[model samples]
Each structure stands twice: as C-alpha cells, then as structure tokens.
Target: MTDGPTHYPPPGAPLPEEPEPPRAMTGGTRPPGPPAGGPPPPPTPWAPYAPQGGGGPAPQPGYLLGAAHKPGAFPLRPLTLGMIYDGAFRLIRFNPKATVGAAVLVTAVAMAIPIVITAVLTFTVGLAIDASGDVESEISTADAAGLVAAYGSLLLSIVLAQIGVIFVTGMVAHVARAAAVGRRMSLGEAWAATHGKRWRLLGLTLLINTVFLVLFVVYVVLWVLVVVVSPGPWPIVAWGLITVPAMICLSAWLWTRLYYLPVPPLMLEDVGVFGALGRSWTLTSRQFWRTFGIGLLTVIIGSIAGSMLSSPASFIGQIAAFALPEYAALLLVLTQAFALVVQNAFYAPFLAAVSSVQYLDLRMRKEAFDVELLREAGIVS
Candidate 1:
C-alpha cells in the first residue's frame, strides 16, 4: 500500500486554453484564416469540461493519495469501498430486480444438470457395487473402478454444464444492463453479442487458467520439495505460512480480473475474446496498482464470507461421512452437485455484470464516458 499524492483543480477556474495554431505559415498562405471570427470552431466541444490538470475529472480526497496528475492525462479517481457495496444495489437500479433474479434462476437450473448427472451416476454406481448376482457380480476392485468412472463422467458433465451457465449468464447480464439503462433488449440481443464467439471465449479462459494453474503447480512442487528435504519443521511451517496467504491472494486477484477479461471490448467495441482481452489489458495497464488493489480487496472480502459458509458445512460433512459411509456418500455427491449448481448460478451473472460496470468506467476514463452519458441523459442539450 504505497501512498500517492492527491490533487484537484479549483472548480471555478476556466479550463486551460488550447494550444495556439502553428504560426500560419509565416506570410505564405494566410489566406484561409478563420472567417474573421466565426465562433472559433465551437470551442472544441470537449475543452470546456476538461479539468485544469487536463484530465477529464477532478480527483477527490484519497484519490491517488499523494499523487498529482498532469492535464490531459488519465487520472485515478477515488474508488471508495462503498462504491463496490453500492454496485450490488446498482444492479437493481439499472434493471428491474426480476432481471437479476431471472439470471440467477437460469444459472441455478443450468448448474442442476451436472448435479443430477452426478447423483444418478453415484446412485447407479453405488448400487452396482453393492449388488451380488449370477448375471451381475461386483468385486471390491471392480466397484471401486466403476465409482471412479462415474466420478470422471460427473466431472465432464460439470464442464459442459458450466459452459451453458456461462452463456446464459452473459445473456442475462447484457439484457439487465440494457434494461437498467432504459434500453430495449431481447434474449436474442444478449445471445447475438457473443453467440458465435463462444469457443473463442472458452479457449481464452482456458489459456489464462492454464497459465495460472501451471504456475501454481510449480509453486506447490517446489514447496513440497523444500518441506521434504528440510532439516527441521521450520521449513514446513514457513512454507505453510507463506503458501496459504499467497494462494488466497492469488485466487482473489484472479477472480477480479476474471470478471473483466473480455468485458470492455465485448460491450464497447463488440470484439471477441482475444480482442477484448487485449483492450482490457490496455485500459487496465494504465491503472494497474488501483486495479490490483481493488481486486485483492474484493477477493479478501468475498473469501471471508465464503469461508464462513463453507467451513461449517465441511465439518458436518466430515462427520456424516464417517458415521454413515453409504448414505453419507450419497449425501456428499448430492451436496457437491448442489454446490456446483449454486456456483454456476451466481458466478456467471456476477462476473459478467462487474465486467460490464468496469467497462463503463474504463470508457469513461479513456473515451469520456461522462460526455456520452450526459448526451444520453439529455443534460448536454
């Protein structure tokens, strides 16, 4: 948390003048000088609103903390923790509550497919393993193998289920955003934006996760080696201490960017995954520290909340597994399925939405989003 200076211009000061035109060819072609004062090119339209520092907006307290921005540069505006909390509220404001609810519902339904698949597989495999007949006999090894296969199938089914959830969530977010802003959008309107580009998005996501996963595995392996080869328990203790926090921080950082990877260009420029990623990187690069800091904060907050819910369920689950293996197995399978469903239900829309909002903010910074917003609001007229 390095601090930076924060500065703002006096509100009443007229924005600085435009640079003077090149000295009119010094006596050569002075013929075309502006029609003897015909309204001076309408004041460049954007000039009057520019901040004295040349950025579009004045910084507030805690914005940049101790940093000064030059005129005509992008400034990091104050982003309070309250703004994020309010973003959830904004979802309802921008669209009817029903829209967000519908998105969540669709996500839940999409998630259920995998759970159902898992439950059916578990039940069938479990029953088959416990059966004894001339036609169908099961050895312990055979039963174990079948169970493993069933689990594999369940994992595969979940991947497909998640993809479906992704599409539905993106569509829902699109419609919600448009509707929130009083724009008309159909189900097709949402689908139309990303329909043909699904594979590309998937591939891009795979690439990113792959990179992170590989790095993670390498980190884990190195830590394990250190522990095994260590002379004492100090190495193990130190590794655990560092790895736990690092993993937590890593997960949070990833989640924040996950929501925005393709959002800016997808919503604004209408580009596909790769283009959107490139564009997002460009916009985010300028404000890396702010982006990373805010993202880490969100993750930490969410992790705390998630841990509260998951920890108790985990202990209860462990007790059930030991007390009643067969019934507990079924319950465990069911619980896993349900968890998947819930995750898909909420994650897709939430990610899509935050990305959309961040896209709006990015455009405001880079392209003067406020100007467009004012125009749309009829404030500029």
Candidate 2:
C-alpha cells in the first residue's frame, strides 16, 4: 500500500489506495447499486378478493339452511312431533284468546263455501226426486243408490279442493319463516307469505290432485269390472292379493315423491310445476322409507283426529229421530267438514315446514350449497 502511493506514475496510472475499504453498506449510506449481503423482503399478506365493508359479512339463508345437512340436522331444534305442537302453541301464545278466535274465524269463512254448495245441491236434487215421486209415488232402490253415489263424489271433490287450499296456506307460512331474518315469524307474516304464493300454490295443488284423481278413477273402474265380470269370492280374493298391494305401493310412492314436491323452492326459486316435481322426486328418492313411515304416521294420526272430531255428528245422526232427514244430514255434513278442517290444521304446517327444511337439506348435501348461501347472505367475501 505504501509502495503504490510512492511509485504511482500519475493519479490515474496505478494508485489503488487499498480499494476504498470496500464501501460499508448501511441503511442510510448504502451503495447505490447492489448490496453486499441481504435477504429478500417477506411477501405481502393475503388479501381476499372481496369488496370492503363495515362488517366482515352477513349470514346467508343458504348457509343457515346448510345446518340441516349435518348428521342429525333438524331445521327445528329438538325435532319431534312435539316441534309441531310447540309451533302451534307459539301461534296461540302470542294472543291467547285471539289466536284460537282467528283459527275459528278462518275455519268458518272457509267452511261457508262447501256448506252452501252442499245445501243447494241437496235441495235441488231432493226437489227433483220429489217431483219424480209424484209420478211413481215411490223411490226405486237403484235410483236412490245412484243419487247417493253421485252426490258423494261431488262432495268429495269439493272437500279435497278446499283441503288443498289450506295446505297451500300452510306452505306459505313455512316459506315466510324460512325467508325471515333476525326473528321468528307470526301468523300475520305467514298469512302475508301465503297470499303472495296463493295462485301458484293452488295451481300446483290442482295438477297433483288431478293425477291422483285419475288414479282413483282407474281403481274404481277395476273394482266395478271385477264386480260385473266375476261375482265370485275369487274376484275379491284376487283383487285383495294383487290390486290392493299395487294400489298401496303406488299411493305410497306417489305420496313420498310428491310429499314436499312443491313449496319454498317453488316460492323461493320461482320454478314451474314440473321442475318442482322433479326436485321433490330427487330429494325424496333416497329416503323413501323414512318418508313413507312419516307419511303413514301422519295419515294415521290425522285420521284418528278427524274421526274423533267427526264422531259426534255421526252419533247424533243415528240417535236423533228427526222429522226432516235432510236437515239432519246437513248438520252431519257441516260437522264433518268442520272436524276435517281442524284435523287438517295440525298437519298442514307440519308437512310444509318439513318439506321446506328437506329441500334445503338436499341442496346442502349434494352441492356445497353453504358456500352459495353464505355468499348470498354477504357473510363470505
């Protein structure tokens, strides 16, 4: 180093001056070019591709619905028939006297349609028979049976149509509860929801009931043919062995397939009739037995309740030696209709609510539907 300073020919020739001590690299006085030794900086934090908001995200219906899919997931916690009882109890608890009063009011309003129809049809036919009686002075057995059968069929159809409407109303109640946020729903909200989907619901009921009615007609035809062609006990035996099971199975299959066949999805998704049918079929296919048992139980219970409600009218008719048989029959018919409506009231919301719950369950199980639901609810970015 000393020799380089003494023997340097010129300032630019051979003077090195110990290479400038390698130029220390500090944060403030670091070299302008590459650093001597330094590790790369850490990468940035992960930022979700989500829109910014005050809250992280809000809960979605789909995600809340997803809770139904887990191994023992019940849309209503502590699930059982008791749940239905509890729900109905809640309806009354809100306004003790008013709730029962409202149910009675609605029931009375609904019953008037059928009651009027029955009374008018009875009087018209009675008058016709009376007019014919003047010519013969006696009613033939065959004519009497024919009149009774025809009237029964007419009344049956009317009853079914009214019952179908009540089911539709119940469905609307379930949908309202499902779509609610932050709180449970009341009958008023349920009625509001019912009103919105009333037309669509009635249309669905008509389509499904029409199919069932056609099947009933076929069953009737076969029964009549058996009677006409083979009056022997063997025809009865054969039908019992073959037709009964077939009818039962067919009814069960159809009932299970269409059980929850239309509802929240129809309301929520705005699906057409066939699409709702298809979705219901898909959802119930795997759990047919469970559905069947549930349906069978419902029917049995409903029948029992309906019978209890209706038993009084039948007993009264048999006991009373009334001067006017027609008036007595009218009383029985009205009582039966009122009882049926009450029995129906219990099962209506149960079926509708369960179906809606099962619909969401299917979506959750098959698709990662919780994700979509969360996205919709704004809970997930």
Cα RMSD to native, each candidate?
Answer: 15.4, 21.0
lDDT of 1 by residue, 1-381 (tens): 334424454223344453544332343434343777575533222223557767644544532222222111112232244543355345544443333454455545554554565456556655232222211224566556655655665577566666665565456445534532335455456668666666766776677778788878988898889978999998789888988898877765664454444643554466776676677677776766666665555445545554554456556655665565554545555555555544443444454555455555556667775455544533344
Give me the candidate number with maximum TM-score.
Answer: 1
How far is 142's C-alpha from truth in model 2 (Å)? 24
Candidate 2: regions farther than 4 A off: 1-105, 113-164, 167-176, 179-182, 186-188, 222-240, 310-341, 357-381
Cα miss at 109, model 2 (Å)?
1.0
Q: How do the residues 1-381 of candidate 2 rate in per-residue lDDT, one tens digit apiece? A: 143323213112332333322333445653354355776544433433334765533433333333332211122332344444344344334432223333444555666665665566456544122222221113455435534654574476446646554544444445433442113445465556555566667677778889999999999998988888886988788887998999988987897788444565566665766777777787677767765665566556656765776667556644441434444444545665566556545544444444454455456555555455544444345
Which 10-residue window in model 1 sums to the lowest lDDT? 66-75
C-alpha positional error of residue 203 in candidate 2 after TM-score superposition, expressed in Å:
2.1
